[model samples]
Target: MTSFADLDLADVEEVAERREELLAAVRDHAGRIAYHIARVDGGDYGQRSFSTDDGEWTVKYEAGDLEYLRFEPRGGGETYVISTQQPAEPKALAEALEDYPAFVAAYNDYVDSLAGMLDSVEASFPQVESTESVVTERDRIVEAIEACCDRMAGELRRYEGTEYGSFAARIDGTRWELKWDEDGASYLRAGGSGGVYVLSQYGPPSAADVREYAPRFGGFVDAYNDHVAELELDLETITFET
Candidate 1:
C-alpha cells in the first residue's frame, strides 16, 4: 500500500477513482470463486445455490474491515460460508480469502490519502472572524457613537433657549446633525448634509430614541465598518469633529 503522508498534494478524485477500481477487482475475484463453487455443486442435495452472476448469491466485503468476505443469498437468507477443512470442494474461496489482506491495506491507504487532502484544503482557507470578535467590534462602534452623542448633548445645552438651534459633526466624511426648536422638539440625522432625518420626536431629545432607533444605527454601523475594513482602517481611530 502506498503512503500519502509525505506528499505535499493529493488529488481526492484520483484517490477515489483508484479506490473504486481496486474494490471492483476484489468483487470480481469473489464473483469468480462463487461461480466455480456453484458449478461444482450442481444443485446437489437440494441446495438451491447458483453462480453469483445468476443473482442467486451476492458477494460482499464486511463493513469497516473490507478484508472479510461473505456471500449473501438473494431475498435474505443465511450467509454462505465454505469450510477450509473441505479444501477440495471450495478451494477457490479459501484461496481468495488469503489475498484479502492486501486489498484491505490498499483500501485503507486510499482512505488516509483522502483524509490528508481534506486537512490540507481546510488549512489553506483563510481564517474567518469569530462571533465573539464580531460582537465586540459592533459594541465598540456603538460605544463610540454613544460617546459622541454625549459630547454633542453637552454642547447643545449651551443653546438652551426658545429658539432654533442645531449642532453638527463630521466623522470619516460622514455628517451627523442634531436639531431642536423653541418647543424643545429635536431630530437626528446621520448621513450626507442633505440626508433625511433618521430620528424625529415631538419632545426633547432622549436617549430612548437611540435605543428605539438602534436598528437603524446598527445598519449604518455595519456598512461603515465594512467600508473601513476594506480600506484597512481602524474604527477606533475615527472621531467626530463638531
Candidate 2:
C-alpha cells in the first residue's frame, strides 16, 4: 500500500504550507485580540480579520472583552460550530490557537488514510493491461471496484442493532456479501454488473471488523501476485473463448 511518503511531492508541500498558514492566522487573531485589550484597557472594542484553511474569520471584541468569532468559508461549506456570543474567558484564545493545528492534522490524517485504502484496493485487485475492445468493459468494472473500495474504507462503522454478518458499504448495481460465524471467521464476496471477486474465509477481524478486512484483501492479493510472479505466468497462458 502507498504511504504518505509515496504521495506527490507537490501535494505534501501544499499540506505543509497550509498548516503553516493556519498557524500564522491563529497567531494573528490572538495578537489582534491582545492588541485590542491593551489599547482600550476596558474601554476599547473592535474586529480583526484572519485567514483559515476553510475561510476568513472575524474575531470581535466589545469593551476589551472577546465578543464572538465568525467564519466565512472560501468553499462555502457550512461552519458546523461558531463561537459562542458570550464573553470568552482569559486564555481561551490561546487554547483555541493551540488546538487549531491538532484538529486540522487529525482531519488530514483521516483523508490520507482513505486514499491509502484506495491504493491498497487497486494493488490487491489489479486490472488486466490491455487495449482490446473486449477489455473496455472490464476496465469499467475495475473502476467500480475501486469506487466501492473507497466508499467502504471511508466508513467503517457498524450499524447499531445490525448483525455482524452485514457489510456496511455497497455500490448501486453491485452485490456485496459478508458471512461470519461465532468462531471469528468471515468471508467477503462482491461483484456482479461489475466483476466477480471473492475473499476466502479469514479470521479474527479487527476494529469493528472493517480495518482488518480491507488489509486482509490487500494481503491476499499481494500473496497471489507473488505466487503468480514466481510461476512466471503471462497472458498467453490463458485461452479466452467468446
Q: Give the top-scoring candidate (lDDT).
A: 1
lDDT (Cα atoms) of all candidates against the true structure:
0.45, 0.44
Model 1 regions lying over 4 Å from their true place: 1-130, 162-165, 169-174, 179-188, 193-242
- Poorest 10 consecutive residues by lDDT, candidate 1: 82-91
Candidate 1 lDDT over residue span 139-225, tens digit each:
564566555444444444543443666655565556766665544425667676666455555322234444444555545445434
Give lDDT for model 1. 0.45
lDDT of 1 at 20: 49
Candidate 1 positional error at 71, Å: 52
Question: Which residue window of length 10 is worst by lDDT in model 2?
Answer: 153-162
lDDT of 2 at 148: 48
